[model samples]
Target: MIRGVRGATTVAENNDVEIIKATDELVKEMISKNHIAATDVAQVLISVTNDLDAVFPAAALRKIEGWSFVPVMCMQEIPVPNSLRKCIRVMMTVNTSIPQENINHIYLGNAVSLRPDLKAE
Candidate 1:
């Protein structure tokens, strides 16, 4: 079976270092919480708010030891009026047997307000 694990995080500024760091942290947490291996990931789709464009979030995934071959794409998030700024979002599609409701969706930093219902404990 295939499932999508979602996650989002915010960075303090629109810089390459900060974007990479936050993306790495967010993806790692999502993988850890879901007990997913790099090989299990089919693809990763990342999006950043309009204010964040210093770097492509996919760069962070490539730095992971076993994620060199994992397909990744980075794009800009829709500029919704008055929406959260400096936010990075990720959706990882993986081959898993875990039930939908049991899958962990992580939201960190100020992004937590984006999805309070899925906030990790």
Candidate 2:
């Protein structure tokens, strides 16, 4: 079976370091919460708000040990009017038997406002 684990986070600025750090943190949390291994990941799709173009979020995944071969892509998020800014979002497709509803969707930092319902208490 295949499932998608979603996560989103916000960075304080558009700096490469901040973007990479936030992306790494968000993806790691998604993997940890879902008990997913790098090998189990089929692909990772990452999107960042237009304000964030300092770096490709996928760069963070490549730095993770064992994730060198994991397929990852990064793109710009749609600039919806009044949307959240400086946000990075990730959707990881993985081989898993876990039920969809049981999958944890993580939202951290200012990005929590993007999905208040999914934000951990």
Candidate 3:
């Protein structure tokens, strides 16, 4: 069965370095926590908030080793009132047998507040 893993992280700044660092951490965390390999990931879709125009999240994702085959897309997250800033969100579609409930979703920094119910213990 195919499954999807969701994750989000907040960058300390909109600069290229911080943007890539935070996004890289979030991607690695989501994959490692779920014990999924790069080969298993079919595609990745990422969106950044309006405050994060310094770079494209997809470009950062593609820099991961062995991810050349992974299809990645970057888009702008719909702005809303009082939404989190400098946020990068991702949805990874993977070919996995894991049940939906077993999938791990990652949220870091202030982005954790975006999904408080998924907050770690």
> If scored against the real structure, what TM-score would every candidate get?
0.97, 0.95, 0.93
Model 1: per-residue lDDT, tens digit, 1-121?
A: 9999999999998999999999999999999999999999889999999998888889999998999999999989999999999999999999999999999999999999988898765
lDDT of 2: 0.90
Error of 1 at 112 (Å): 0.3
Q: Total backbone clashes of model 1?
A: 0
Candidate 2 stretches with Cα past 4 Å from truth are none
How does each model score on lDDT? Answer: 0.93, 0.90, 0.87
Instruction: Give every collision pair in model 3.
Output: none
> RMSD to the native, candidate 3?
1.3
Name the candidate, 1 or 3, with the larger TM-score value: 1
Error of 2 at 46 (Å): 0.4
Which tens-of-lDDT digit does each residue in 1-121 have in candidate 2? 8998889999989999999999999888898889999989889999999999888889999898899999988889999999999999999999999898888899999888877777542
Deviation in Å, model 1, residue 95 alpha carbon: 0.8
Worst 10 residues of 1 by lDDT: 112-121
Q: What's the lDDT for candidate 1?
A: 0.93
- In model 3, the Cα lDDT at residue 90 comes to 96
